[model samples]
Target: MAPKPPTAVTRPPISDSSLVYVPEDVVEGYQERIETGIDWTLIELGAQHHRRKAINREAIPTITFSDGLINKINRGYLKGFLDDTSCINLDQQWEQILPATLWDNEKFATDEGKILFNGINCLTDDLIKLIYKAVVTGNRDTLWSELKMAEVLRVNNEKITELDVGLLEFKKLVSLNLCGNYIMDIEPNFIPPTLRALELQANHISNINSFVESLPHHLIYIGLAKNLLTDESVDAFSRLPFNLTVLDLSDNDIYHLDPLLDALVRLPNLTSLYLVGNPCSVCATYARLILMVLPRLKWLDSRQVLPTDRSLEPYEAHPDDLRSSYFYFTVFRVMSAPQPPKPEKGATTAFHVELELPLLDVERRKFLLYRRYESLTEILAPPEEEEVEKAISTVLRPSTKALSTIKGIDVDEASSNASNVYDHLVTKSSRVINNFTTFESNKIQWAKVMNFQEPTVKIFCPDLFALRNTFRSVITVNLVYSIVYAKSGKTEKKSSHALKMPTEQRVVLASIKCTLRNPDWTQPSQHFHWDDSLGTDEAIHWGDRDLAVIQYTQAPVKVVKGKPEADPATSSRQLPPENLTCHFGFGIETIRAS
Candidate 1:
């Protein structure tokens, strides 16, 4: 290795021309190893443009960008954001892009554009998917028609303190992102009635009591990371109208652990929680308390929580266990997946998972499983001497190799169960509405009696950990998919529900009574390469038969047009397709969130 080349610090000035890269100072110890090829793998320092290939799926309509979101300033419904996208750099000043005077300039017309909208003349639902309207000022009704039609709005990093952005006027708004602002409190009715994902991360929010009770029942993912949340905000968690699957409180002011723990228990559907930058996370027993307290939590901080993170032992004895216990956790990450025009047809031995949705339909499919117990200590605890003997005598015996029946004194799956809760939110292009799913309480152990990769000296509650107990824990899991109707849609018959009602319709195409019997205690945790159960329903196919994959269709909560009422009343109307199709994969132990 030799260091001979001198490097320059700055690159060519940014311009409309193609981007070019320049070299910078070499990182300390590796200064002389630029040419070294380890195992024939050479390191190349280069830069390339991230080309965003357009999605060919018909579900996502192309979002037409107007002059408003372009480099030139325009006076219209869309205000602020001189750049193409909605983002304010950490150190970006407000005056640089969001010029208040430019939007309110007297030169702009004030015709309200009601006639041009209303989907009759210039606008068709197919042509437009999303419109970026930042904030309201001057005349609140200036963009009234466009605002009413908006399903997803980004008002991030606008230095807004009060929740007085006139967002309440949005009738069909579903996903509202207000991250990187100065909001301190979420006033009553501040959130739109139809919102599902409220992203408020990187704000200055502190008080939550004023708005938790007012949050719409269907709202699921709430991002409040990098804010000023405290222990007081934890109580607001109990008042949320619905279960939250993903919550980000990573960098906040919360200090105590018990009150936060007590509050989180109210949200039984919470599977992923972020608390990295808070003071409480620095505690020695932070991960242990959270993993044990919230049995449903899957992702914590930078890694996925595993069986090793949970312990039935007392906290006082946890420090000693921490010194020895070990497992693997995957780092939290975001990946860009661009596929070919059509999926490659060939498939054989490699276990693969794929989801095919209608173009522009922003839908998410997730599969999750956990023991119903809040504290798995009893089940995973060191087995009692007699119980171990019973398991050895009853389940692990050589004579019982072919015996499939259970004896009278075998294990039981009667641990106090907590319901498995996760909501299915449907989004067509920019629209997102709530769809619900219910699961019966079932005994789901996060880990087996013994792991396959371990020195298998661990004991279990033998009578409880018997193979029979595993069979007894079998429960029904349903995989559902549905469609939600918006306010602007009309049926072919021109029914009354389509006239003015905010009705939603559900179509459950797939519901499988799946008892994802885990592997013979060796239970290949996540490495199962089997797709034995492939249920084909046209475009929708189900595979990965290890644990399961599910597409939740909201149970009909309300009736519409002389039927079981369920309507979201969105502006982008999605009439139920005459021919419905879905693709689902189950048994694979992978939970995906969007």
Candidate 2:
């Protein structure tokens, strides 16, 4: 059979080289031959042309491999055995040839591979090999010694997902830059203890508590920008390592600074802090409040903190404003009414006394004197001439020229109309005393007075001697009086009927004892007085006057039935007089040393 028609020239076994390298070349040669072929009308050519057209219509024009073939190629590429250039059409291949698992392996499996994949342009294989050798040998001293010459390792924008534990074996690495990566979490102990500075900007980290807890105590600077940090997350820094001096947390999701500020105060050694692009940065008083809260911070948001930004110290009141030295005076009035069958023999009469005092300023020499008795309508009524004279004589003696001058009264005029002038003086003095008392009381109320320096005096009914001894600094004394008169209708009725009146309706009185002191007592006493009844038109006392008036007497006055007579038993004795006076007055002078 013509040797079985040459047995169809059984094809030799395909060699591995031809199978691997001749497929694209042979396809190209056949495609060129078919394109330039003659006889376009022959049935076989027509059939071949129809088949070629049909294949072209059914297949993708840009792709030459079948789906199975592409998948096989991708599998090989993912195994790291094939590159983009090995494909016939790289644009037609899947965009990503390597699987996520293979990518992780290539970037994190070995130190040299990680360095290369991390896009660390400044690193060399020599350092990586040394690190590997040190890690395998478990010799930290050797690693530290080798890494001492190079203290920084930056692998920024590397798209690295995980950190190799072997990398942290370098004990001498001081600064580490892993910025712009896809790292989601940093397990504890991933950072070397010797690192002083670490930068982790633009990453997918949400919580850093683990990293913070494992941080080296010597770390001084850290950058954690463009991360998913919140106010709650910042609380992790409440117990930050004391040596961390610089911190950056810009472009985070922090909404409130209160928690962050609360945390920052715990980092006593942190001098510089950055919080730009956070929500708290929009506050107008953010920087001012920060400087106030963090007094030791030297730099904030990359700007030097000025001293003016700090708040002023608390205000303290001055000693003079406290009204430290002051005095007060009180006045009391006593009224006695006669009852039916009044007080026979040794019965004691009862009088009602009322005392009222107000605040005074002794340093300023200010006092409040009684102007008008509120309970007495008599003081407001017209007064009799004799009663006015008596009141004036009691208040202004003949030797009180200084007081007259102070009262702006002419001695001659005052003597001629002593009652009217004295009435005017009393009214004016009351107004002045009330006004000054109110003003000083308001001042004391408004100011922050010192408690220990305030002097207070309270007195009820006491003996005259005890009252004088109570205030030893008093230099002068004066008793002022205001008289009340019955109404016109009442006076007419009393004159017609001549009926006895109750003491409450017949008498009204008030008194005030003013205590005064002069800081400069060396000056001579000045006195001017006007009293026509005393047989002195105008008198001036050159020195201090001692006027003694009996306040009260316990013994009742005794009256004789007839005239005085001699006693027979004792020849030198004489009987008592017909009448006796219950009141007494004495005037004395004090001689001062030159």
Candidate 3:
């Protein structure tokens, strides 16, 4: 291939009446080259004046410069150069020349008046500031990605640090990528809160704790690889929001992976972790330990490095095992919405799950099953194997298919005796929290039972808070298919409860005077009402008020057997919606530091 002619880098000085024009001979030369029909594509290099097209009310082009020579030059010359050139050198000399001519003693009030200013590259920091300001305050919502400021450097020789890059005008700048730089210290208040993604990989940052604190909570991805971070500042990294997913702490001086692991476990939703070049000797084992602690982790960089080899020796033995044996851990994740009494369109509620198991290490048979629960009360101990087999033989009349599925048991009567486990436990200490007593025990043992038994039932109101004119407003909505044994006989009944209050309860004026503290209620509630005066029937304040239990007001409600009728006197003991509601925003009372 023949060598292409190099274009001369010559830029004319901008003047009020220079009549900046592209030589017509260059366009004619390109046309002649094209007509020759050579194998190589011909490209013309020249600068032409580009006028801004006026926009009409309909956003349609009302008028456009009809200079045939300029249009043809743009289409034929500039298009060819952009298409054929190996690399388009946009960092031209004109940007510097133009800015040098524009900057004067006065601070430019508006970017609009600078009709001749082309933001290509002006070495002066003052000029960049003007461009930055213009980009920020202009009608166009400019993101850092769109503002190609990196290309305008007059000289890359100067040792530029975070202090040197004074982004006073670029206040709207959110995401910044300073991956390869000699930046040492990042001032706390230098960056705007709108900034999110910060990539400062190859920097001499010894103390990133301040940087982490200064960053906004909206930060999603923070890459600080190849830095001189010591163990002393490692704990400060835990202060980052739980929503962070991608954290690259690979090539740092981080030893003793336990603190990092603990911090990782605390994150509610961190899926990807990259810690390859750190001081992790048995990195595989360490990663597995982390996985054992954090069940939700999907990708670990060490796993990608050494696949098929489990880091931990024991877990490596059981290659086929799906469950990680890291002493059971419960993770709470946000749920979609509240389970309403009735579904409403477009209504959203958030929920979180809490794992219910004691973190214990043992070779127990029940530890195999990973049961997810919102609370520990839901766990019921399983029954014994002997009793389970007996129950299976007597209660369950196994069919041919059921008999064939039983392990090691023949299709004869032995198969009928074989119990189906996983559903129920035959343990004595298996306790279910009924209304009598809430499930207070921390541990719930499962029995290797004979027959499959259903789980414990829980009853709750559809919208307990919504129900008015009642005491003990919302009742527990019980779980279905839970069978209970009665002395009369074993009966299958719907696990449901009724909310009833006492009648003929008289309110004494002394009770009101002794009980109410603030005597003012700001929020609304269906439960209690505030009496207007210190001793009058007129009620003023309502809703949930923070008050101390100074005295017992009244035992206003009594439970009646069967479906108890609603009592009018028990109006104060109701909730707004008589159903199960999922609480999302900080527990009922959200407290911030004073």
Candidate 4:
């Protein structure tokens, strides 16, 4: 409701502050004239006409609510306003169905604080027996006829813990306000099928797994505000009746918007909704996601929905640019990888990543954008021609310094059979993701003062983009990288001037997993920094100059540092740091299907 001062009712005997003031119904001339004597024939005709109209309204529900009928009623209402006449006493034509109150166009005000209701009426054992007897015996004068005959009931702010079985007796009940009670669970067969609206707000009720199935199919509105609701409570909403249109869950404990929206998308008729004061409402993409997930909504909270609400510019990469856009990636450099102290393993394969990034849809997905867009192929398309892979070097870049003498550098022998040991070991799923798999090379390196410069990598997954989660503002993707290490061996010195050749033995030091948090467009590209150490408590955060130190998890890694080696004569392990952050990109230079 708008926060305007209440309007005044214009009736002389009674006044309502909530109603807009209008002139009292009055007239002179022919309007006030009345026949001195009534003709029996005319009176009988008038009574018959009135009876026929009333019968038609109830018998033809569709026609009664048709656009023409509603428009006539609205014209009468508008005429009342135009003539400066009051509606305290409505015309006989409208008195039967419409309430005698202010016009909907007139603003009304509510008191401060959460909306509440005060209901004390309830059916007792005597009333139940009387109602049953009245139904069986066709009696009308009993007490049950006077009570429970009304269409609306507000039994709020009570100690009621569950839906009352006796509530099924109200055959004409249209709305039931059971808010501000202790309803922890919902049992079947209690709610009347005729009930159209229900209020379960401000209660101890939590999960609604059974509530969805128990709900009456005719119910169109529900209020579960100010409860202990969670993501689990709304997971079963796909089973809710399709006729439901309005729902209120304001001031609740719903923090996971992904699951909640995923469930709500199945409720096709749901339009007006309220989620104020809930933890999910505070998410950065809360409004955009809600509108995207439920575009049929005509009202959200107190405001009317708008066309602009569907725009996702505030949350994700400009999806409209996908046709012209490209998915690209670059391994700029490992910020501070230590050079292997072994003089032989000069340039070991830094990171070997054999990965499969398939567009997957799983239950309880942490990322909501994936569900909205469905697949990367849908959001992004292949260009008319494929772009060539840039001459990227995942290998170390050539040194800028000049070497006076070049020795018998056997680069091909060091690379040969480098992946023999670690190729057999595979990476399994992590706790958060289930569709991931990886393998690394066996060769390893221990950097003393090795610095990684920007290196180019062939963009493998071109049909990919960052996916955003409703709860977090950043878009992220997961990747696993291995730090290959060389196996220890004694350096054999060649006789005389003939220098000895370095042995080819390799081992996988460790394979680490990382999540790339895409930087916003307004901000400069963020760089990745090598982690000082490895631990479970490590975090992924931005550092100075947009560089972030990634402390990745090693849950499914192939090997740990202290694991036993095949040769006892080999030197002690000199494992390199586990993490490094650098410039990265994933433009679509090449496209592959999963």
Cα lDDT of model 1 by residue, 1-594, tens digit: 897664443222222211111124323432113112111101101000000111122332322112112211133223332233546531131344424433443346355644222212122132122222222232224334654566776655344455643566667877877665455567675567788988887655676787888888888888887666777778887776666788888756677667788888889788888875565554334566677778888887746776766665544323322112111111111011111011112311111111221110111111101121122122333335545444453443222112212333211222122111112222222132222122211211121110122211121111111211122122222223222333443463376332232133222323322222222111222221111134532221122232122112223233357764334332122232212222222221111111
Window of ten residues with lowest summed lDDT in model 3: 44-53
Q: Model 4 off-target regions past 4 Å?
A: 1-143, 312-594
User: How does candidate 2 score on lDDT?
Assistant: 0.42
Model 4 residue 220 lDDT score: 92
Candidate 4 to truth, TM:
0.33
Q: Write the per-residue lDDT of candidate 2 for residues 341-440, one digit (tens) a residue.
A: 1112332222222222221111111111222222212234333454554566555433334456666866545453222222232222211222221111
The TM-scores, one per candidate, come to 0.33, 0.31, 0.28, 0.33
Cα TM-score of candidate 3? 0.28
Cα lDDT, model 4, residue 180: 53
Which 10 successive residues of model 4 have the least lDDT summed? 395-404
Report the candidate with higher lDDT, 2 versus 3: 2
Question: After superposition on all CA atoms, how large is the RMSD of candidate 3?
Answer: 30.8
lDDT of candidates 1 onward, in order: 0.39, 0.42, 0.34, 0.42
lDDT of 3 by residue, 281-384 (tens): 12213444555566666667634323332334333212211111111111111111112121123322211222111111011101212221223234466455
- Ordered list by lDDT, greatest first: 4, 2, 1, 3
- In model 3, the Cα lDDT at residue 98 comes to 29
